[model samples]
Structures are given as C-alpha cells and as structure tokens.
Target chain A: MSADFATCYPLKRGRAHEVCGPGATYFAATCCNFSDKPVLWVCPSWQQEMLNPEGFAAYCDPARLLLARAASQIDLLAVSEEALRSGTVGLVVTEIFEPLSLTHGRRLQLAAEAGRTTGLILMPEGMGSNATETRWRCTPLAAGGDSTLQCWELIKNKSGTFTDWVTRWDAAARRIIVVSKTGERPRVARTAG
Target chain B: MRARPVDAPFALTAKESNTDRIQCLNTRAERAGLSRGMTLSDARALRPDLITRPADTPGDAGFLRVLARWAGRYCPWVGLEDADGLVLDVTGSTHLFGGETGLIADMRVRLMRAGLETRIGLGDSRGAAWALAHFGEGVAPPQQPLQALAELPVAALRLDPKLGIGLERLGLRSIADLTATPRAPLARRFGNGLLLRLDQALGTQPEPVVPLADPPQYGVRLTLPDPIGLLEDVTAGTARLLAQLCDKLKTRNQGARVLQLTLRRVDQGSQQVELRLARPMNDPVSILPLFERGLSGVEAGYGIDQLRLSATRVEDLAPTQIASAIRQSQTEDVAALITRIGTRIGLENVQRMLPADSHIPERSFILAAAAFSEAAPNWPPRRARPLRLFPPEPVAGAGPVPPVRFRWRRMALRVAAQSGPERLAPEWWLEDENWRRGLRDYWRVETAQGRRLWMFHTPQQPGWYVQGEFA
Candidate 1:
C-alpha cells in the first residue's frame, strides 16, 4: 500500500545533489543537452533546429521514444515546463537545473501537489539549484564485475538533510542496490515559509 | 596354282587362292570343290571352277544407309528397306528434291560412284516397291502392290519362310492366288495374320516407330563430315555449337544458369564438362570464354567428331532497362561479372560474410554465397574493436580498474592507454560457449601506434584475451 520510494527517489544520496530536494514530491527532465533545457532534443543533432517549446513538445522521434521506454523510475516528457504549469505531472524533471524564482517554485509546488507523477530534472555537472525537494547527485561508478555497475551518489532528501551513498547499478536487471551507507538525516520542508 | 584335279579343282578353296588358272577355264564350268581359293585343275577335277569374286553384301548395305540419310534431308522420313533398297515418303516434300523420278535418279547416280549396283522401284506402297525392286525385271511402273505384284512370285513379297511354306502348301504360291481367294475362306483357313502383314507393307495400318529424342533440353548438336583432331578445331566447333544454342535460348526469352559441354570422341567415349554461372545469361560470347578455361585442362585424347552444348538450368531473361542518367559502364552489371569470375575460378571460392545476432565476433558472421551480398550491409558500426580476437585473456586484477599488465599468448605488454570496462553480458537464452564460461567486461586497450585491441576479462573463467582490434 506504500509507493516504491526507491524507484521514486533513485537519485537520493547520490551525485545528483542539486536536483533532488526536500519535498514529498519532485520533478525533473534530463536530456542530452542541459544548456538547451526547455528545448528537449526531439530529433538528433542533425535534424531541423528547435522552433518553440510547443514545437519541441510535438517532436517525437524514435530515438527519444527508445530512451523514454528505458526509463524505470520516472515517466519521460517532451515539455516539463508545461507539465509543471498545468499541474499534469507531480514532479517536472527538466534539463534546466538553474535556481528558480519564488514565483516559478510556487507554480512547480502547486503542480507537484496536483499530479501524482513526480518529475526529476537531470542537470549536467556544476549546475546548481535553489528550490527543489532534494539535491541528489550521481556520477558513473567503476563496474563491480561484468554484470554489476556502481554509481557515485549524494542524497538531499525533503528534510534538507544530505548524505552520501555508493549505489550499485544492475543495468541488465534495472535495479539499484545501496553499497556504502551514509548518515540518516531528519526531513525538512523544501518550500520557503 | 598350276595343278588341280579335273573333277574337283581344289579339296579346300579358301577365300583368295590362286584363281588365275580357274578364270582361264571356259564358261559354264561347274563349281565342284572350289571352296574359295583353288588351283584350276583341282577345282576342275572336283566339279569345275565356279565363278567367284567377293561378297560385298554388307558393304553395299552400309552404302545404302548413307544414301538413305541423304534422302532423309529432303523428306526426313526415309528408312532403308532391307539391305539393297530405301523407302522414302516423298508425299509432302517431293518437290524439294525434284519429282519422285528425279530424286530416284539423283540417288542412283550418287550410289554408282560409291561403288554400288542398284535397281529402282517406285510404288504407292512399300510392299509394291519391294516386290518390283526384286522381280519387276526393269524399272517398273509405280503401282499398288495388289496390281504391280500380281505377276511377281511369292518370293518377291519378302514373306518369311513359314508364311511362304504355308502359302505354297495351299497352292497359292503367288500373291495373285491370295488376292483371288475370298476373305472369309482365307481367314477361316490360314487365319488373318497374313492380311495384317500385307496391310502393314501397303501402308494401310498404323505402326508406331519410336524415334530417339535429343537427350538434354538446351542442346546444340553438330556432326562433322570429317573427324577433327586439333584442339583449335575442337574449340572452334564448340564455339559454333554454343552460339547456336545461345540463339535458341534468346528466342525463347530465357538465359542459361548452367551449361554442359559434351565432346564425343571418335573412339566411342565422350567427355562432359560443366560450368555454373552466378547469374543467368544467354550470350554465348560471355559463356563460351568461361568454359574455354575449363576445356584447357581436359585431355582430348585422339580426336573429337561431334560437339554438343546444352543449357542445364535456365532463367527468364528480363532485360533490365537502365535509366539514361544511370552510368552505363561495364561494371553496371555486377552479377554478370561475378558469374564470369565464378565460372573461371569456382563458385565455392567466392564467399561473403553475413552478420548473425552474436556479441562474439567469431560467432557474429556466417559465411554465405557472394550472390547473397544483399544480406549483409556495412557491419560493425564504428566502435573501437581489436585487430584480432582470441578467447578472453586471463587477468590478475579483480577490482574495478583493469590490470596494468596481462599475459596474452607468450607476450606481455603493460597497458599503455586503456578505456572502458564496457560490460556486455552473454545472452543466457542462447546457449553460447562464452555464456557457460560467464559474462565478460570488455575493455579497449591500445598498444603503441594506435594498435587498439578489444580485450575481455571473463568473470567466471577469471581470465582475458584479445578479442579483436580496430583497423
């Protein structure tokens, strides 16, 4: 009767520190490019240029669909900003990981409360954010063996509590097991009082 | 040669004894004991020297059969009737060889020079001609056997001894007697067997004569007047035959995929040479040269008198209409070129590698025919691969980072520059040799001069080997 927290919070205590924040729900969108955040790569780098947010949302190429189908923890989207504004998705994972204004955060908080599907925005390295449920970070780890994969992580949960954990990733089985345990921290409100 | 008995010239006369003295004897001499060759007195004493020369009956028959084949050229329905006569049905084609009489004279003149004596008989039926040829005295008027054979003796009918005896016993020795008798009385007395033969000889009955069919389908057969001994001559003969056969195929709107050449030697044996084409083609020039290479290795012992070229497998000749803008170089028809090469070298020699669903490089490709080139596209997308791949080479290190030095073959090299622990798990569903050994973590390690190698360390086997290297 409880939701799958592991699937919902795959970036907890990981190198994806800026995206995961202190909140009951979160949303983010990670694409091949972080600089062009709202502009999801609907086509390959060789295709026509990005027109507008609506135009980009309509672009559904096979390669993007293939990647979308592979996503285990979250549902992939073409327009994360629209999903957040319309309260369609609980969490909008955007490629943009910049600090949001109070107004933007309020809109996202309202949308996340409305939709059940939380969005996790995948940001590139060195990107930071001010408003999020958690700021968990992730990096490719050394492979344990032929079948086992390790990913470096940092978890920033809803309580604004931070911890580090080495998660073993089984790509074949699509399961992530925690290897090195980190300190447990108290939960905190993500939105400003 | 000088002495012989007056009654019996010779006790035994072989085929060619001294016959000069016997020839000097007067005419109307008895053949007494002159067997074959005998002295004059010996032959005369026995009985007398009989006039004898040589028996050329068989030689005469052979000559007549040749003339029959020549006559067959006109009507194509000519058969030698016994040893001395030919029966030709000039019904439809008599005008081609002139009229019936002209044709007969022409045949006779040709036979005369070939050292043969003959008689001419023309009739509406074979039996009439046969009877007239034997007993008509001179060139008889063309007649139906019933009328022209009236005066001819029973012997002239060429009836077997049993039938002749039966007729003679009945006092109906001549055909005339048989004709006068009523059909019912004849049937009741002697049965109707005699009537059947009479009707057959008169062309009133249907007798099925089986003709030999040309054995292979797409064949061209050539018969030379004189046997050829030279290889060049044989080659030329083969070329002519191939050309003719190709023409036949072209009109049929088909092309040959395989060809078989039969060289019939004069010594009663034949040689068959076959060649396969990668693609179907009917052009003799393209196919002839292909087989000529194969013929070079054949031992044409004495000589060849006949050459036959036949197409074994044929395909519909769909002439491809190339767009005018498309390049019209010789290389445009790759199938034709491949076929030519395949013919000269061997079809098995031209092979292509096709991709299968396997991570293992060795297991990835399956050898296929060059004709199946369409099955394979540019393979192995640009990924760093080894120049060669052995089984996984054993590595000492167990942790994440690859071993600095590992033994491959007998040579050991320190890792100069390495990338990747790209893990490719063996498909468990597929029973693979590598799967039984466990999974592999592949690494692209480069030696000196960008000599990149793909090395995999088996987790189960706990070893590694160079799998492949990129070019």
Candidate 2:
C-alpha cells in the first residue's frame, strides 16, 4: 500500500479489470462517467436486479448506457467480448455469477486491447476472477448517520503500486467525493441530510 | 437414402377418428404391403420394423408452398394443388429447357435428386393434367386431351364420391363410357359436373391457372457451376447474393430488415439462414457481415449447388443526402454493434433506457429495444435513484421503520447510517399494482458490510422491504 498510485483515479483504457465486493456496481457505473462514448452493461438474465435509471443517472448518464440481458453467463461473456472488440462503445461492464477462467480473461483482455475499449468484469463480493490489468474491491464502511461511506481497495495493479481510497457518494451532486486515501486517518463524510 | 437406407419401410401417419392411419407411405412401405388407409397399429403388427412419424399437416402445406415458389425457376405461373401438389403452368415457358420432353425429364431428374418421388403430368388443360397424372399415362399426345382422358377412371375427373359410385354401379366406370352414354342423361344425374369436367378435360372449356401472388420478391439467386460444401464458399456465395439483393432493394427505395439465405445442396435437403437487422439497411457492405455468422450455422451437408437470398422484411429508406459529421459515424457504429449483439442474443434483450416523465422509480425509465428505439439525448439532470432496483423482497424486520439490523438474502446486515423516510404515495389509478401499500417511507441504508441498499416500509402493510442496491 503506497501513495504512488494515488492518481490512478480512472482505470486504464483498452484493458480488462476485475471489480468485486459490495460497491462493485458503484465503481462500474462510475466508470461510464469517464468516457464520452456509449457504455455497454451486460449481465446474465437470472440476475433479477436491473439498473434503475434514477440511481444510475446519479453516477453516469442513463441515456449513454446500453444494457444487454444475456441468456446465460456464457452469453454474458460472449456479448461483452463482442462489445469490447467492436470498439464502438467506450466502456463494457460485464456482471457475472461464475468465476471466469484465466484463459477467458486473457481473451477478453486481448479483445479490449485490440479494440482499445475499457472493460470491467463486475462480480459479487467474494467471487474470484482472473484479474487482467487491475483488481479492486469495494466495501461499504460504517458511518454514524444519514450518509454512506465506501472503501475502494486497489489490492492489485499492473501499472502502478497498490492503493485504496475512501469515498463518499454525494447523490445530490451526482459525484463521488474522495474522503481519504491509503494510510490516511479515516474521517466521517459531511453528508448528513 | 439417409432415412433408414431407403430399404426399410417408413410411413407418415395422421390421427383420424381417434386412431392413427397411414397418410403417406414410401415405395418401400407400399412394397412391404402397407396401404395408405391402414391403421398404424395393424401396419406395425404386420411389419414390426416399420418406422412411422405423425404427419404434420400444416408443415406439409408449407413445404408444398415452398416447392411452388421453387418451381418458379421453371415456369412463372405456378399454382398450388391442395396440400400435396403443385400445378405449374409451363404453357409457353417450356422452350427455356429445350423442349417439352426435355423439360419433363429435367424436372423428373431434379425432383428425384431432391428425394421427392413426384408424379408429374403434361396435358392440354388442368383437368386433363390432373386426370392423366393421377390415373392415365404421365404424358398426353399434343392437343389430344380427349384421347388421354377417355380411359381414366371416373374419379379422375374430380367427381363427387356419391356420383362416382353411382356411375360405377351403372357400368360407366371409365370417362369414355360416360361420354358414350348421352350427355343429357349424365348431366341430369350428375348435376352437370360430369359433362362440365369432360369438356374441361377435352380442352373445349378453358381452365385458368390461378397463379400464386408474386409479392414484390426482393430476391437474387446464384447457381454455381459446381457444388461447394465449405463454409467459406457459402459465405462467398452469400456476399454475391447480398449485393444483388441490395441492389434490388435500392431501386425500390427500400431496405431489408429480415433476410433469408437458402443453400440447396448437391445431394441432400436445403438449409436456410435468416438474419434480422436492427435497422433497415440497403447497403451490402453493412448487411453482408451479418450473414457471415448465420451462414456458419448451416451444415453444407453435401456441396451446395444453389444459393438464394431474399428479404422477408423491408422498410422504406428514402435516399439520404446528408453527409453527416463525426456524430453520425459514432451513432452508426453503436447501431452496428447493437445489430451484431442483438442478432446473437435477441434484439429485445439489448435495450436503451429512455427517461420517462414519471416520478415512480420504475416508471421513470423505459427499456426500449436498442435496435428499434432512437437514442434519446443523454439523460437530463434528474433525482437520485438506486443503481439497481429489486422486486421488493421482504426484509425480516418487525416494524414500519428502517431496522437497526436486518436479514436479507440470508445475510445479516447491520444498518450503520441511513437516509430518509422519503414519503411516496401510490398513484390512485395504480394502487392495486403498487409495489407497497399506503405511503411508502423510503430509506437509503448503509450496512456495516459496505452495502448501500434502498429499503422502504409500507404503513398499511406494516413491513419493511428491500427493493434495490445503490452500490
């Protein structure tokens, strides 16, 4: 845990990254805010929870998102790979239930690199998947009242040193306000309603 | 030969009067001594190894219709003859295949090659053709319909079954026998059907062939000099056909939405690959690659001798004169990607969330099929909504308030920080379909596990329910 990777606020483009833990969707949705082109969000059909435009709009423009409900985990990966390889969309976030193999992860990495599109593989809190470029975990942190805090842990990085950041989601401002960084004293967010 | 070596008897059965009877039988089944009307059980008992399948009546009719369309390669005016036959009016079109005899031979060879044991007849009129094909010699002397029909059984004239039996009882079993007897008596007994049928067969009365409607067929076909079985060759053939078809579509100011590619093999049956586009496209460069993936699913089986591309769905695409800037290319790129992905998974599965003028979280947005819906200008500034919404699952909490700690999806979550009891009431018209009852108190709860879940409590239902996650 070093402060050297502090400026890695936006993940690298044209590569695949793994994001897990409770706030993974938050990180994935925020990734859409970094680019101007369309965003592709692919998930398996059985995952009944859908992106609410109201919540999604707080982080990324809901209009810029193209949601694909793939019939299965295999199709989920397939469609995300196709979307990434097409280079049309600025970003592709694939949500999966099962762990992807290292080879499949490598294939997706290559597809993203070939198309120069950013790809994020989103999974549930404990699910392990091959990390192609960077791996980050998001956990909801305790706060006293009326506001939410999150810890984004950059546990693995290929281009920079490992670092984690604490952030508060300011829904009204529709932005993520960084609260603290690695090795810093944690402080409560000024987000009381 | 593929169906049980072409030696073992096989029959197609249809249920009639609560029992399965043979509707059609192959020559092998006929040689094995099973008749068309025999009960399937009796046939199976007699020939224990006989194979039978329930005949699909509608499917058979569809197959016949396809054949009638295929028959257009020979004659333009082809009409359907019930579910089992095709009446092709090859009157002036016979010269294309050389002569009448050559045409008949050619048709017989092609039909037999396709494994269809067809019965074809040539005559001066429709009645003579039907009668000669069903009863007399397969061919008639030119302009000699009377000579050909004279020996046919009375049933061959398409007579009423009762009248045919009455004619049989009077020893007038043959058409000549009925004609020899005075027409006045036959007409009086048969209600003019006998003489009318006789005149039609004799070419004295004109019988028009009601041709099938040629619906603006945007189709192009390629007949290869030699059959090709490889996937690459099929793809190449598709490209050629696509260009030709796109040209046809362009002249009419239309674009193809659904395209069907049919590949007829050298030895076996044909395979069809259908591609449905997200938008109407008349350009071959854009449409050709869509066929690439679909064509791979086709098993060439033997070499493919013919490829036909036709558009089943077309939309009016008035010529675009605009040379759009950078935005159009990007929009077109996204649309192209949508089409590619949509074609694989269903087009309905790929969607764009369009904002709606509603306060209800679910009603605030609509998922429109990405291919069909225009992209709305990026979302307008709006109220905060949960990232993911769930169908309200009951939280195991007691009161009409956000619990200090609650269990959801079998996980114990301790609520550390929480936001409002934002009051939202059910629309009067939507009360019955409301997700929760009465005024809903909505809360944004942050769990000790770093979960940001959106929960609500119904005042009337007296229960706390988790509906979405913000993370």
Candidate 3:
C-alpha cells in the first residue's frame, strides 16, 4: 500500500487515506489533483452544502469530479466502496459523518488495493484507524483573502511517523505547495504577496 | 398489462369526476353483477373480494395498439375502435385462415390462450363490425348488413351518449325505429352524424379502417423449456436475451433508449421491469447490469415461463459515432459506471458540476445529473470562489462594510483580515427573489479564530449574509 505518491508528502496510491478536521473537503479535493482520472465524490443526499466549481477549479477540474449523493450512510459507503472496487475512477472520496468501523475500513482498503484506485475518506472528527494508509488533520491557516492557506498535519503516517506543513494553493501552478514549517500551535505566516 | 383469469373477480377502476368508478370489469365481476360506471364502493359491496386496480388509460391505449399488432396475423388493416376495441379490415385476407369463421375461431382461441375475453364481430363495414362487437353476436352478412343491424340498439351507433338518450326518449329504441322515421326530420333533429353513422353501418358510405404504422421493432423474446423463478436463472435468461437484442439492434444500427422486460409467469400473471438509459447503449455488457439492478428482488411468482425484452424507445446509433465513442472508451466506461450506480441510487443522484454562463456565484455552476450530461474537458477560468457554497445564511450583522465581528453557523468571531467589497450587480432582466435586495458587496473575510468565510452586505437592505467558505 506504500506506493509513494510524492517523496516528502504523507500520501500513497491504491489505499485508504483519512483527512479530518477543518478544510477536510478542500484537502480531499486537493488530494484528487494528483490523478488525471475522473474523481467520484460520495456524500449524503440530504446535505445542502457542495463543492464550489470556482474554488475547486484551482485544485482539480470540477468537470472531472462526479458527485454521488446517497440517502444514507451505508449507501454512501457502499457507493464509495463500489467506485473504488470498479477501479475505473481515478479517486474515490467519501464524506462520512459517522465513524468508520475497522471492518469497513479494511474492506475499503482491500477494495482500493484490488482496484488500484486512491481513496480519500473525509470526516469531521479524527479517529485514526489501523487499516488506514495515512491519517492527516487539516486546519485553516492565516491567509484566507483571495487564496486559501491551510496547515496540514500528518498525524499518522503509514511508517508510524509524524510530519506537518503549512500549505497554500498556488493557482498559477495549479498545485498545493508547502509554505513553511510549523510547530504545535500554527502561527499566521504570509507565503505570497 | 397483467393477465387475470376470467374466473377471478378483477375490475379496473377509474376516477370519474369525483368518485372512483369501475371502468372495466372481467367476467367474474360482471357475473357478480358489477357493471362499468358503477361506483367502486358499490361494486365492492356487491363483491367484497374483488381484485381492483386503477386503470392506466394511456397504457390501455398502448396495449390496444399492441393488440392490433397481434391481430395483424389475421388481417393487414387493423384500426383502433375507440379505447377498448380493435377493428380489423379482413376483407380479402380472411382466406388465409380458411374463411371468416376460421379466422374468428383462430382469434378467439389465441386471445383466450392469452387470458383475455373476446367478443368479435365480422361485418360489411367498420360501423357494422363495431355495432355487432358491442351489442349483437355473429357476423352480419355483407348483402343484408342493414337487416342484421336493424335489430341492434341505437347506442351501438357509437353516437355521443347524449344523442343516444335523446333518441331513446323519442321512442327510437332500435336502429330499425330510426330508419322507419322520415329522413329529413331525423337529419334536422339528430344531425348528419347519425345518418353518416347509419350509412356507414349499412355499407352505403365509405368507412376505412386505417392500419397503424408498424415501426421497426427492436425486441427479442426467449421462451424457456423450463420455467425459472430464481434470480440467477432470470439473470442468465436476461443476459442471453440481452446478447440477442443487442445483435438485433447492432445489425439495424439502433440503440435502446428505454427497455421493458416482461416476465410472463406460468399462472398467467406477469411482472414487468423497466430500465431507462442515460445514453443509447447497444452493448449487452453495459446494459445487462442495469437490468440486473432493475430486476433484483422482483417477485417471479409461479415462475416465469416466457421472458420478453423490448426496446420501447430507440435512437439511431450510426457506425461512425459508435467508433468515435469507443475511441474515447474511458468516458464510455465512466458512462457505463454511471448507469450502474444510477440503477442503485437513481440517476439524478449522480451529478457533475458544470460551469454556467453566469456571474452570480451560486449561478456560476450547476450540478447536472452525470448520466444526462456529457462532461466538459475544462471549466471556465478560475475566479476567487469558495471551496463550499450554500444558500446564504443570514448573519447577525449590518451596514455596507464587512462587520468587524459577526456570527455565522452558530460561531462568533472577530474579522482578522478582510478583502474586497466586490460589487456584483444582479441581472436586471432576471427577477431573482434572493437577489431582490439588489446590489451586494462581497467580502472575503478571515475570522480571528482561523475560519475563512465569504460574506456579503446588501446596500439596499442594510443586512449581511454569509454565503460560502474557503474550506
């Protein structure tokens, strides 16, 4: 499962990855930027909130992302799992309000491994699972004017290691890059003019 | 249309004005003295165990057309007789079935085999056939059609009920009574419609039975040697049928837009499963799963002996276009996946965000059902848009400028950094209720506690609202 996506980044392909806390959806969308294949985003049908194409365009093409709304949590997971199992979608992202059980996480992991597709599980609160390839926490940082700057903490890397970085979406380059190193408490730091 | 044994009390009720009334009843209900136009509750009181179903009038019309096609085996010309009957012009074609008697015998046997009752009539004209089918019995001889029709009731002329009642009140109980009266007075009172009908019945005026246009049928049926009730067996049967139907469609270069699968049970009852395609699909590999999804958990009561798959709606799939679609097979696969997922959670639930031609943030993009839309290669040029945008939730803030501190989504925070009073004017031509406050000055505000929010203030209304978030 430790198929390196990027050398320094705490992420991998063909496995389950968890992104929690503030800006988790944005981080999930950012993760999809790595693949050119179409993304399947699974969410609850009742939710009125959705990704803004204008903002999502800065990271990944909104056109590439297919939104699947399921009426229930089980359906949401089932859709994500099925999409992952199909191996057709480049990335499968699911927004789960309930905690992902260990068995469900393993099944998703196996599904991702079998299909060779990247899986991003978004949650409001973090309960890092053993079956997860990596668990990360994303918090909104200083610059929120024109562009988004966020502090990303790699809480649980696959190799039992920890790494953290302040990142910002570089619009012209169309990629998120590390802005600076941050300790326990993140301080406001300007990365761009 | 499901087949019901004539012995079973079955009635199709229809909403008539204010009350549900029996539109059509089978022999069982009729034997119980339940008649058409009778209130359903009265019929229910007469026969408590009556199997009642609301009639689908349009569906019955469609079924009548199908019945006409079935009757085509007897004669070439088959025209619909109102809603519940069919008129077949078997003028010369009757010889193929040995004669009028033999043709009728064959029709009766076939319709009865299909669990339907038939009251057929062979006559010299369309009106004579219709009248005999409804009010009289046996074929009316062509040379003496008037003599046969004279005994029938006046209502059999297919005149409006009001006219029939008016004629009946005047002591014209039969066609014989109407003809015995003076033609000029009858013409003045009842008008020429009655005469036209009378003439058409007696073979004086021409009445053509215009046959229905037979469209290129894209259907395949497989009757099993052994009836199947298991889902696996049904799935296998569906796959075989799919392969055959796809081959049929492929040769004609047509793709099914809507498919209906009818599984006829041994007990004469039937169940139907329908699949609507997001795109025209000819491949069995792509279409089979959708059918499986549609057919899963469908009750196969008494085991299904016959499986008929018909493409109720089809679209042209030219060879060149199919070749091009295959070249972009990745998209083809995605479309297939969408159809599969759509079968589970509904097609409308799967969506793709498409950038619209609008400056309004909410109207800038639309979530269109992925199955119904083709994905664009790229979006419109990136603007400063929030990561998540929802309906503007009113915040406790005021004035044209961004408030120094405000509450949103139940969180209160002071504004740390503020950007833009980006004046976005409403589209004057389009009346939008939300935009009724008029010009809004948007501000990208960062809260002191580290939350990015897109807030707007209306100059005309003097109120602020939070519309979106960066995260």
Report the candidate with higher TM-score, 1 versus 3: 3
Write the residue-wise lDDT of candidate 3 on A56-171 in tens digits. 88778777889999998788888888889888899998988888889889999999999999999988775546788888888887664555788777787776567677788777
Segments of candidate 1 deviating more than 4 angstroms: A1-193, B1-216, B322-337, B340-345, B357-359, B372-382, B387-401, B448-450
lDDT of 3 by residue, B1-471 (tens): 444344588899999898999999887778889898999999889888998889899998988888998888887888887789888889889888888888889889988888777898889988888899998867898689878889899998889999999999999999989889889999999899999998888889998988888787788999988889999999999999999999989988888888999999998898899887778889998898778777886888778999999999899875666557655788777877787777778889999988798999989888899977888877778558888988888888777778887777677788988888898999998989889999999988998778888899999888899899886
User: lDDT tens digits, residues B1-471, model 2?
Assistant: 335455679999999999999999898888989998999999998999998889999988988888898899998899988678888889888899987778889999998778888788889888889987777647777787768778889999888889889989999988888778988877787787778888888788899989898768888899999999888878788888888888888888998888888889888588888888888888888877777778778887768999988898899985665776465668777877888898789888998889887667777789899888887877766645677897889877777568888799899988877878888877677655655477788888888776778898888778888888876
Better of 1 and 3 by lDDT: 3
Model 2 lDDT at residue A129: 52
Q: What do the candidate models score in CA lDDT, each in turn?
A: 0.51, 0.82, 0.84
Model 3 misplacement above 4 A: A1-5, A8-10, A127-130, A182-193, B1-213, B300-302, B321-326
DockQ of 3: 0.47
What is the lDDT for B456 in model 3? 93
Name the candidate, 1 or 2, with the larger DockQ value: 2
Model 2 chain A weakest 10-residue run by lDDT: A184-193
Candidate 3: count of backbone clashes, pairs at least 3 residues apart or interchain: 0
